[model samples]
Target: MGLWLSCVALSSADVRISVTNGAAACPCLGPAKHTPYTTMRRMTTRSTSGRPRIAVVGTGGTIAGAGNAADGAPSAAYTSAVTGADALIAGVPALARLADVQAEQLLQIDSADFTDAQLLLLARRVVALCVRDDVDGVVITHGTDTMEESAYFLHLTAHSAKPIVLTGAMRPGTALAADGPANLLHAVAVAAHPSSVGRGALVVMNEEVHSARDVAKVHAMRLDAFASPHGPLGLVVEGVPRWYRAVTRPHTTTSEFDIAAIDALPLVGVVTSHGNMRREIYDAWVAAGARAIVHAGFGGGTVPEYLKPVLAELCAAGVPIVRCSRVGAGPVIRNASFDDDAAGSVAADDQNPPRARLLAALALTRSQGVGEMQRIFNRY
Candidate 1:
């Protein structure tokens, strides 16, 4: 009888970080899967009047979870947990009096599902919103998965002077202990702070702030999984943000990819490098009609010698090839090892794959030549 009781007690142990609420199991999101976010409904929270009009854009993630109790044990606490955009706002008490917020469901997608079209669409929404006299800033609810990519996309495209901050959750809001609420609330506080302006798009996660271009999902499963490859740009504590570094790339309220100026861009491909390779993929892209290819090369942008000829052929064919390193820790510089005689393509040495792809496509759309695109990438 004693053994039976002990076993039962041991089965119900506190997992995850025990918070004021309760404990969720180790995987926090139990058999986590990629499911679209729930639909947007009229979620009511206390609102403030005479505050700067701020737009709350909901893109989707664990922040909008909907799970049932039957899926777990008896003491599994709440059977079903549901969180809305309004709930994200309410979680942080600091935002209620600071801004008049309006929630808009831009898209209900896991950040992993984000695509080029979605990036453009979100940028367009931001561009339209920032010009309004009543609108002071923009806040986004995103999945930590690919939050950085989307954030960087907005940073390069939106060109806004107002604060544009993206927030995400490592654990679902339904979990006994979730990080979504705090992260969302902090993002709102960051957005509403006048001092937050002019920093370009920012990612506020786990109390650490990062410039979008530098941040990446470094850990697979931790509340504090995200990290900026170049270290944090700043941090947030007690509802206030403090900065220490500057944004190095061209961004925010100043960029060549203006919202109204761009319409259609050429098709650009990013090929990641690894040991022992083939030119088949490059040839395939060229055969299938790729206008340009961003080579995510190995270690400071070095490509296999066997593939160099194919790259040269692509360049000779008038298709641009932009060299960017796959390692992503540093820039990809132009030289002989990465490119033979700098013949066929331009270098994306200083930019990540996403940024490189953006620059390549934009360059192709504008100048329509490899040399011109190279100059544009360098200038930007």
Candidate 2:
């Protein structure tokens, strides 16, 4: 009996050792990476070691880029970003003092590859973290590529009291005097500061804070790559926030659409009208699977007459359509230019094509039927 007991104890010890080694090898079992950005939550550490435990969720973008070749170009940058959250934070020690930081990798792909479903997933995860008590706020280190889309999605959907901020470096970390550390350190400072709350999902860059909805990539290859055509919400100077105009929309922990009872996303399509436009492009997409089509019409939502017959057919077939202007700014009028608002067609006045597309898709996804879809767009 004593020999049998010793064998059992030995077996247990060996099992534990194996488990420990396995845990150490895999990332999920170790010190949580990218906590603030992911859907999953982690244990509160006693470390008190870093900033205030602000989770840095890593969604792969240029932010996670590493030079493909060694000694290739110090100006051409590279990082062993096997992980984005911890790796970025590790590079910026200034983050260590601004907030208790935990890294989490949500989506580690280039932001350009992101789709509607991915945006939904990221929004869901950010909302999940905001509802938790242990987490103070969240910061997303995203690729500047599609950062605006994700930011706007979060701004429109997620409900949160904590500050949700997205930041990235224009130049790679391998570049001389890389800009990432400074941007990240400032992002952490803004994420931890109290004034950042109540504002919608914000993009912090070049020490400037811009609303996700109003901000866009104005410069092609500059450190100040993003610009809000209307202007910035505020500025972050040496780790402190100062706001000018008060954000008035129902956002941050107070949005019905943020946590509304909606699950499956509606089938939406984007159809751009070009010179000598043919109907086949629109017809093929409708035949494929598009429930609603956002017609990227010319100025003021006007479409070529050649395609009008097809659009009329589309309306007859019961596919809901919204006329969104391809123009970067301005509202899409309901019937002012299309000459068909009197019918089933709708307009997305003043909203750019992308934002209009998102609104149209989301609106259709919510309503029970086509009539409801039109009503959703009109109501909004």
Candidate 3:
């Protein structure tokens, strides 16, 4: 059961590869076109017997970054997402031994630069790959800056039981002890593992596997920056993944979100409520075409007493308001002492401000009612 690559040139610049039973088609991994079938040029490699077929889609981040000559050893000041998917795959030779690996370069940019349209496109690509009979799992190489948000977006919309693992490095690949190769290897391992199926989208880094909904990048430069406050679902040690618990949240195939039919997401914004927070910030977002807003409030989603009236007024004006916490870990309770449910506001259980914004945007695409928005938050 060895992997084999069969290439067919659709055009002079485009090549389509069919990797026997090991890995499926290797088309262009560049920016997605109007249709999902457009092909691009990339190399493909085969694998050993009885290996799972894994596809690695590269959307650059620190894992693909490169340092300048002025930077010291293990360079910290490198440009992100400059490296290609081919180089990343070649850097981790061990990946070839585990599964039939296929590589594609989708985008080359910092994760922080990820736009809503790109997120939607990525979700569409992941869903397309998962539905294919040959692709057993999908591994996304992303920047650590906004990996959690992207992972969560895919988690809610992917609609697949096949493993979708996201991984990235805090350090550049050119660094003395680059973490990219190892993280990519672990991601592939998790993607190929049978246990990873039906686990929804996962973030694999520093040997830890976290559910997308719970994982966050808490540290700026540390290699172990990503963690789940509720603890990780499992870990990978020496290329073997061990489970500690199963994710109980409704996600993936169980989620009501469907990205396939959505071409564009509704406008949503996030405003942080702080000490002496001005009401103008909220006004600006609404003026800027925000259909919904996630107020990243103080502890447990509390807003200043002065801002309450304005929030209620916005709700009356038909913009849905979602309450979320800036403090990072606690659940924002609906109709809690400070939360006014009657004013067309909803609470985001444990989702942070960015994630809450995504949910709000997605929810708005389906319904505008506060109760329905709240139900969407509670279910997802």
Candidate 4:
């Protein structure tokens, strides 16, 4: 179990420290049951009071879980995907004040269990919703585990200029001080705001609005989990989105990739570097039908001297190799630690391993040459 919280406070007389530990297991674990209210339905977009019609699509995560039997206490013991989209929307009535919100139950599985088929289905559904004449924006409720990957995938594929916001909680909704309601409210607020247009997909969590390309989950168990190395594009202050910066990279309407035309994503493998690594692992991944590989290398995307020949051989054999740093932040500059041109490998810039895999998979659909692949990485 991980340390849940540690807080320090200072007063006139003394200093006080408090500590909390997360639950080892969910006490309320049981078979999942469907509630009658959890069904998907569409509502009229424009009402008597015209508001930006926002669609709230739910794909289960910790935000919709009910782990503890207790009513008002924080506990990590819970089953995920227990709650439904309608219930989540009903819990946050303030969402209606921000926009004409409607709930659509897309899936009720943990995001770690989320499959490539489900991802393609969700992307198609989101694109369908965004193009509708009634809908103005879309908000996705997802698991924090893989939220950044999904956000970046949508950022690359979805061509709509309307806002797409993704948000989730670190704690279950039934827990004390559950973060789902507030995060959802902020997500809807950012989606409805006109300022969010043309910013591509956004991840709204812990009151910060991050562009999908830059945001990554930095902490495993913290309310402020998601962060951008370039700093957040803005913050949500009391239901209003305040802007500070903008995304310069190509995304959404500016991007060349299209979700509707992509029926499947190519298989891309990621391997991390460690002490005394062997070349057989790379061979196994390639044999398993990986079209490309992302090497999550040591600092500065350095490869072990012994393993370099194998990577070079793979690149020469027509499989594209991408060199990316395993570190949390920083770019994998081309030809910095190794001669990328000589090895016929591409650099991942500042993108992390998982993101590099997604981009590599998408890039293969258009072209497979190392030069074009590197250009795609550089431009996107």
Clashes of each: 3, 21, 1, 2
Give me the overall lDDT of model 4.
Answer: 0.83
- What shift in Å separates residue 299 of candidate 4 from its native position after superposition? 1.4
Superposed Cα deviation of residue 154, candidate 1 (Å): 1.3
Model 4 per-residue lDDT tens digits across residues 82-133:
8998999999876666678889999998989877788888889999999997
Ten residues in a row with the worst lDDT in model 3?
A: 37-46
Taken over the whole model, the C-alpha lDDT of each candidate is 0.70, 0.68, 0.82, 0.83
Residue pairs whose backbone atoms clash in candidate 1: 69-79, 159-253, 332-349
Alpha-carbon RMSD, each predicted model: 13.4, 13.5, 10.1, 13.3
Q: Per-residue lDDT tens digits of candidate 3, residues 98-176?
A: 7888888888889999999789889988988888777878999999988999999999999988889999999898787
Q: Candidate 3 clashing pairs?
A: 28-40
- Model 3: runs farther than 4 Å from truth? 1-48, 69-74
Model 2 lDDT per residue over 71-147, tens place: 66754455423446788889876565466788889887877788887888888888888777667678998888778
Candidate 2 at 141: error in angstroms? 1.2
Q: lDDT for model 1, please.
A: 0.70
